[model samples]
Structures are given as C-alpha cells and as structure tokens.
Target chain A: MTATLAIGPYNQSERPALEESFNAHVVADPSEAAGMDPAARSTIKAIAYKGHLPFGGAEMDLFPNLGLVANYGVGYDAIDVDAANARNIRVTNTPDVLNDDVADLAIAMWISQGREMRQAEAWVRDGKWASDGAYRLNRKVSGGKVGIMGMGRIGRDIADRLAAFKTDVHYHARSEKQTPGWTYHADPVALANAVDFLFVALVGGSATEKYVSKEVIAALGKDGVVINISRGSTIDEDALLDALEIGAIAGAGLDVFVGEPDLNPRFLALDNVVLQPHQGSGTVETRAAMAKLQRDNVAAHLAGGDLLTPVN
Target chain B: MTATLAIGPYNQSERPALEESFNAHVVADPSEAAGMDPAARSTIKAIAYKGHLPFGGAEMDLFPNLGLVANYGVGYDAIDVDAANARNIRVTNTPDVLNDDVADLAIAMWISQGREMRQAEAWVRDGKWASDGAYRLNRKVSGGKVGIMGMGRIGRDIADRLAAFKTDVHYHARSEKQTPGWTYHADPVALANAVDFLFVALVGGSATEKYVSKEVIAALGKDGVVINISRGSTIDEDALLDALEIGAIAGAGLDVFVGEPDLNPRFLALDNVVLQPHQGSGTVETRAAMAKLQRDNVAAHLAGGDLLTPVN
Candidate 1:
C-alpha cells in the first residue's frame, strides 16, 4: 500500500498522531514533493493538509493515485474544489468541530473591543489608574444592536452567545434563517446601519470577496465597531484601513486580515483596533478534534467508506 | 435649604446633570470641604459621592445636617455602612444598573484569559504571526468548568452568560440559592478544584477579605485561570502573584487589584496575565444610569421619602 502524505508544519505534539495513523510521508510544501522519487509520488493516495498556501490543479497533477484531500481546518479556500471535483478527487474539511471555538473567539473579540479591555489593561499596567483615579468610561456591549454577516453554523453560534448578553441580533444572509426574533436584512448595508457592532462570519471565497464593502463599513457610522472572525477576503482592507485611520468607526476587533501574517502594516499603528492573529479556531481541544477529523476522513477514504465531511 | 455636595471629579458632560438636579456644591475631595464657611458646611444635607475615599462618621460629622450618602457606584465598600446606620444617616448605592456591565467584564475576562487573546493580539501586532506562522494553540473556553466565587446579582449574571457558552457552572457562595443545573460548593477551595476558570464576584469588605485564599489558588491547579471582576480584597493578591510568577496556574484576567493604579509591580512583568484597570462598571451608559440612580436617592432622601436601593 502507498503511504499517505501529511503536509504543512505540524508541531512535535501533533505530528505523532499523523505518524501513528498512516505511513505518512511529510513535506513542508507541495513543491517539496517534486524532490521525491517518481515511484514514491505515484504511491501517494491521500494528503492530510494544513495552511493557506494555494493547492490547485497543478499540485493535484503530481499524484496520479491521489483520491482524498483531508483538510485540517474548517475553511479550505486554499484547496481548488472545482479542480478536485473535475478529477473525481474527494475533499473533506473539518467544519462543525471548530464552530464553537471560532464563535467563542468572535464573541470574545466583540466584548473585548467594546469594553476597551486592551487599553484598560495598559492603564493598569502603566500605573495610570492610581494617579488618574478612574479609567475613562467605555461603551457597553450588552443590550447593543449586533449584526452578523452570513448566518451559517458559526454565525448562529455567535448570535446565540450575543443573545445571552441581551443584544438585539440582526443578520444578513443569502436567505432568512428559521431563527425567530432575529431581524433579517437583505442588504448588508441595512444590517450595518441597524447595528452598533457588525461581525463578519461569511465563508472564504471569491463569491464573498469584499462583501463588507466601503458602503457597508461607512453605514456602520462613527460609534459602530466591526468584528471579523471570518476570512479576510470577505472585507475590503483598503476601505477598512481608511475608516479606522480617520476614526470613521469607533474601533474594530480583527482576527483575520487580507494576506495575514503579512497584513497591512498600517493596522499596527491604530490604537482603536484590537488585532488578533488568525486564531479563531486555534485551541488545543479544537485543533486536536480537527486533526482527528481530517485523519479519520483519510482513513475512511482509503477503506472505500464514505467521506465524513466532503466539501466536494 | 443647603446645597448637595457633589464630590469627586465629574467631567463637564456629567457635571451639568448634577448641577441641574441639586443646589450643588462641588468639591474635589472631602478635605476641600474645610475651605467652605461653617454655615455652608452645616447646611449640607446630602452628598452625591464618587471615588474610593472612605466616608465614615468623621466625614459625616462635618455636615451636621447630613442625611444621605448617595454612592455613584454599585460597590459601597468604602462607605462605612455601620457608622451611617448608627448616625441614622441613610446610605444608598447604585446597583442592578451596573450589573450587566460588571458581569459583561467578568465574562469577557474569563474568555479573554482562556483564549489567550492578549498574547494572540501581540502575536499579530508584533509581526510574530507572519514570522512564526500560526500563533500557538490556546485553551478552549466553551464547555470548560467555570466557578463563580459569589452568587450575588453580578455572579448570577456571569453564570447566566457562561451557561449560554456551554460551561459547566460551579460556584461557592454563603449558601446555595435557587439556581438549577449549576453545582454549588460550600467551600471555596472545592469550587476552585471543580473549575477550570474561577471568577471573583463577591462584595468588598474586611469580612470577605482574602475570600479566594492561598489554598483556593493552589486547588485551582495547573491549566486553571482566575478572573477577578469583584473587589481586589476578595483575593489574596500575594498568592495570586506567586502562582502566576511560578506558573502554578495558567493565567489570570484581573479588573480590580489590591492598591490599584499602584498594584504590585510583579503583575506587569508577567506575560501570562491580562490586567485591567478597575473599570468593570465603567461604561458610559451604566455610569450615567448609576449617576442618575445616586441622584434619585439623594433627591428622595431630601424630600423625606424612601431612599432608592438603600444599603442602610
């Protein structure tokens, strides 16, 4: 039997599980696979993948026996699904398993930004609290109007958590969901205008690219805050940067940014924003679950069983 | 009729309301009242008070006609309630009005600490994410065991919010209340042992001093996070500092501190902790509501009517 290929940088703690599950041929990137002998490459039947590097038809053509691409995270925008479908190559992504973790992070970021927690922490750390008496008052998060873009599984989870805080939840989706009492707006701008806080929870793809446009951001008004736990491509980075620079919006809590890890340097200069690395689903338990789900999909595919969570 | 003394530094925006409501005599501090004529001081009957300064019989004695001490915040720890009761002076505090804000902070702190948001933010801001790839995985907050130190109004609010996040809510209170599904432990240490996150929401005072003791801190074990939204006196800061310094516990999210603004400098050195200035109830909406309630109490007392939300 051919070995399964495990791609991306898996830390010491996580790599063992992959090694135990399969006769794994680990590579840092797809290009590295080219260095291997043709016979070994031909033997690759499955790939356990992580990271945001684009893996398209070109990479797919490398392995003639490739049957499965088990993605290690919920969002698999990096995987060219259309190309995989054309080749009858199955692609499975870890989804619902990471919903709670991502939702938790979105809610945390919203509350943290609203409460000005970062600045408040600095006030205490710098000993300004003692000399200054009380820190300046911040905006209240509870009872505020909140708008969620894309009412998917993770979006619903974020809404559920916000509802507990007594927020009036509003959302913009392809179609109105079955959630009662939550106001639905067809236009994203209308949703933005109605909310003091707008959370981006749309899926990552060209269809949703720049969905949170300049008009939508401007509609949020001066006191409004934007929170993004979704893919960075869902927002227009230039518009967001401009708005944040001039204080057009109150602040933002961003976990994802366009070309993140190498996001726009301008974001680093803003004190009004709370910047987080793309870590919405970065938790030990969630990541472990994701890795397990990814591995399980590969195992099932090799056994000629049904793919667990097929994206294609 | 004498004027009501509005103490503490009320900003221009808030001062107008106090002036409009009372024949107001504004003073920066209690000692500043000494500059006033005896007639003016003797005629003062009500105080619209803010700040952490202790207000006892001695201060009350300055104004022979003093009948009401209207506190502008929820916690009345600094006000000598027994002395007020003995002097037949009515004491009122702003409560319930700030419950959501304080509870929001407590919940936010819990999630922030568990998710390691502060460090995550730094990873993005400091350009470590681009250089170091993905930030390290953090502990999941949802579905974790949570402990509330006191089951007061704020504690109940915290529990209600945590329940929505799927947390197994555990608490230590004076006695069990009517809360269903939540596990209550009579001993604080037992409660600490049962939870991954412990929140301090007890009332402030000597009676509850060091309520979260060294034993409770140790019982929390490793991977435990302490979140304090209550008074700093509720926890043994020395024990907490020791635990944080030695990695005895995972981390802490603290809003209040012992001698805050001048808190133990050791906290600033620790990267694992998220320190916030005492601003749990410091939101514009809540503070405005608190000020209104405080003024309402003073107005009621002046009219020989019932004091609103009276402590004594």
Candidate 2:
C-alpha cells in the first residue's frame, strides 16, 4: 500500500511518528506545492496542515488531494470542512484529548483577571515599593458564580475544577441536562444574568453562531465577565464592544473569535480584556496526544473503520 | 474607672459590636487627623488606620495625641510603631484573622498564572475566529513544584490547597517546620532551584527583607514563577527585572510591592507577570472578619484582658 503525505506547518514530532507507523512520503511544507507543476502535485495522495491558516484568505488547496485530512485539534473552522464534505473527502479532528488543558486555562483566566494578578506583580517589579504604602487587594474568586456555555467535556472538566474552589456552577446549553449539581438554563440570557463569570464551550457553525449577543451581554450586567472557549462566531463582537465600552460588564476572557489574529480593533483598546494568540489546545503534551489521535484517525479511515471524530 | 478607646478602620457591624464590652469610639477616617487644627488634633486620644498612613511620603503627626494605635490588618507598616513606642503608646494589629484569605489568593494566583487563563480568554474576545485559525493550548498546574518563602499561616493554607491538586510542596524558612506533606529547606537559594513556583508568605520586618535576590532568581532559572503574598521587601526588585527580562525566571504574581501605588515601571512592560493592588485579605468576608477582630482587640485592651494580636 502506497501512502503519500502532505505535511502542514506542525511542531515537528508528527513527521517521524507518522512515518514510523506507515510507508509515508512527507511533503515538508504545504506552501511549497503552490509552485509545483501538475505532475509533481499528482504524485501526492493526501496532506495535513498545521499552525494557522490566514483568516478570510483562500483555503490551502491541499485538501482536494487527500482521502483524509486529520486536524490536530477540535476546532476545524479554518479548514473548509463544508467544501471537503461536498467532494466526499473525509475531514477528521482530534477531540476529548485536550479537555484538561483547556479547562485549566479557563479557570486560570477567571482567577487572573478577577484577582488582577498581572497588575499585582507589576508593583514588585517597579521600584515604588521601597518608598511607598501598603498593597491594595483585588476581587474575590472562592465563592463567586461560574457559568459554562456548551457543557461538553471541556465545560464539564471546568466545572469539576471549580468544585474545589466551592464556586457555584451554572450552565446554559441547547437543552436542559440531568447532570446533578448543575443548574441548567435553556437560554443564554438567563445564564448570563445569574453568573458572575460566563464561559463559552459551545461548538461552532450555524446553531451556536451569535448565541452570546447584545441581549446576553446586557444580562451579564456590571461586574460580570465573559469567557469564550468555543468558536469566535459564538459571540457578537459589536455587542461585546458596546458592553465593554459603557462598563456594562466587568471584563472578558476570550480564546476563540469570529475573525481573529486581525482581531476586532475594539478589543485591543480595552484594558479589561486579556489577549492571546488563539492557542487553547496548544500544549506540548496535549498537541502530541492530538497528533497521535489524528494519525490513528487517518489509519482507521484507510482501514475501513469509522473515523474517531467525523465531521458529518 | 477612666477609660480610653482605639479602633482601626472597621465598619459599624465589625468594630461597634464591642460597644458593651468597652468604651470605644470608632473613627470613620483616621487619616483626616493629618490635616486637622491643633484643637481638633488634641481632642482625639487614639486612632485606627487601615492603609491610610502616607508612610514614606508625608508623616502624619499622629503620635502627640495618640496614647495607643490599633491597626486593622496584620501589617502595621502604616503605623509608626517606633514613634508610638517613644510616646509610651501601644500598637496592635489584627494578624491571625487574615491567614485564610491570603492563602486563598495565593493558591488562586498559582493556578491562574500556571494555566495562562487570561491570554486564552483574550483570544476569544478579540474575534480571532473569522480572521484566524486554531486555538493555542496553555501550561498545566497539577504535579508542579510549589515553593514557599514564608511558612506561616497563609503559606500553610496555600500548601493545603495544593494537596488536592497533587502538587509537590517545598518551603524555605529561618527554621524547620513540622508541617505534614511539606519539605522544608533552610536555604532560599536551594529551595528556589528545586521548585517551579514560589509563594512569598514571610514576615514583613528586617530579617526576611530582600530575601529573594538575583542569586535566588538565577537558581529558579527560566520557567520558574514567584508569587508574593508577603511583604514586597521579600523580593529584590532590580534582580527580579533582570531575571524576567532574560527569561531566567518565567513570571511572578505579586500582591505586595516595595514602593506600592507608585509601582516600578519595568513590571508594566513585561507580559509574563501578574499584579494585584496589595489585597491579600481584601475580600468582603475577610475584611469584615478583620474589622470584627480589630474591634475585639481594642475592646480586650480596654477591658484589661489579653491583646488579640499584640507586638512583642
């Protein structure tokens, strides 16, 4: 069995691992194929790309050549999954493996932003302490309210972590859940109104798109915070900006966005928000685990077994 | 019997609860005496200040009329204890009442900073989804090393929180402690080298001052984080900057500073550090509890019983 592999801009451990598992010829870079002649391009049977795909830009044409394009993460919005589905090409994503890391990050943001840890450290780094007064305290976290949107694996994981802190857990999902110790609300607004901190863990696409809008933002009145770990489309940027500008909400911690990297200019101007390059499941251990799963997924697809995380 | 009373900056519910226990007058603004005329200054016999002393800037003439000064919180740096002692004035501070809140904040900072929660949330709020690609995974918290500079009550509380997380706990103190599940090192440099995260919970006075210096920072090396819930003097500012700039130490979460509100400018530039406004015991419950303790301390002193938290 002949296997042709197109390599994406990955962190490099994938190449040797996949090669060891199958007779694979690796295309080291996906961009190099743009200049390759038709005969050269015809030689490759399938490809995998990593790192980041430029937003609102052309989908790298490498997907058409592959029988399976196994993404190393849960979010595959960057890849044209619909286009691949139209062509009957199999699109796979590695999920459930990165839940702990994501949940850890979520809880961390809630505490850092709420407690003003960044600002606290600045005082020591500055020389004013040699001449001045006592340290000022920030907000509280232990008995605060925590609301999770889209209560899947990562959301549930975050709830479990919060349990140790004794925080009250509330979640908003499409339908009510029978999960104990969880107060479920069918609407996001009610959840927003009740929670001091709101988390987004819902999936992307039409159903969850624009779910956390102006109404939800309004519900999360003053001193409320929004944390989004799902797709950027889950939140309405303009609505968030309006809430932030007027101080209707305390602050926000976001991991996903509708149009990232070239993020909304409004977020950059606000000091109340914590910013990062979209790297939620971007840990070394988790990424390696994700890559292994992607490999298993591709091999299974080839072996006539069902895909681990099928898009359909 | 002729009686005199002194209370710290506590609210009505906290300090006034001792009305029947002793003759106490709880002043609303103890710092206002700084600007008073001679007659008004002479009228008040005692005071209670909470972070109200313009310590390093303008010293208030609080001693001439004051027979005793009772501080609200554990730290009495705001009160001129030497000056009060010279005038035969007794100084008292509420110490043990604040251990739990400080400890809770320390653990919160540890988990939040380690996981990079702030950066993750910012990615989502910025609308990175429509314009960009994948989510980045952050660092983990469980099984990491947690070092303590001061193995006092708050430090012990932090150690207690880590038990559930399964973190390896290490502490550096002047003397060895019999704390369970804890490894104590007599040398700060040795402890810094052995741990990934260090918590500062030492005393505020002379002996423990400037304890964490360039040598200790270097010992920790890159990827090490220090959290200061103790006095700002525990860490040497210049050394911390050098460590942070060169990546010798990964980051720090500071609640206390050497100069305070007039914090150092260097910390403002770094992305790795987390800052707070010196609020270890700043929660509503903790503050209220501290206020009640302060009232009780003053009442006990007036009643001729044992002082709650007296300076030896």
Best of the candidates, TM-score? 1
**lDDT of model 1, residue B237:** 95
DockQ per candidate: 0.85, 0.28
lDDT of 1 by residue, B143-247 (tens): 889999999999999999999898899998999989977998999999999998998999999899998999999999988899998888999999999999999
Candidate 1 has a TM-score of 0.97
Encode model 2's per-residue lDDT on B60-87: one tens digit a residue: 3543555456677787766666766656
Residue-wise C-alpha lDDT for candidate 1, range A186-288, written one tens digit per residue: 9999999999899899999888999999999999999889999998999998999999999899989999989888999999999888898988998889988
**Using lDDT as the measure, which candidate wins?**
1
Error of model 1, residue B176, in angstroms: 1.7
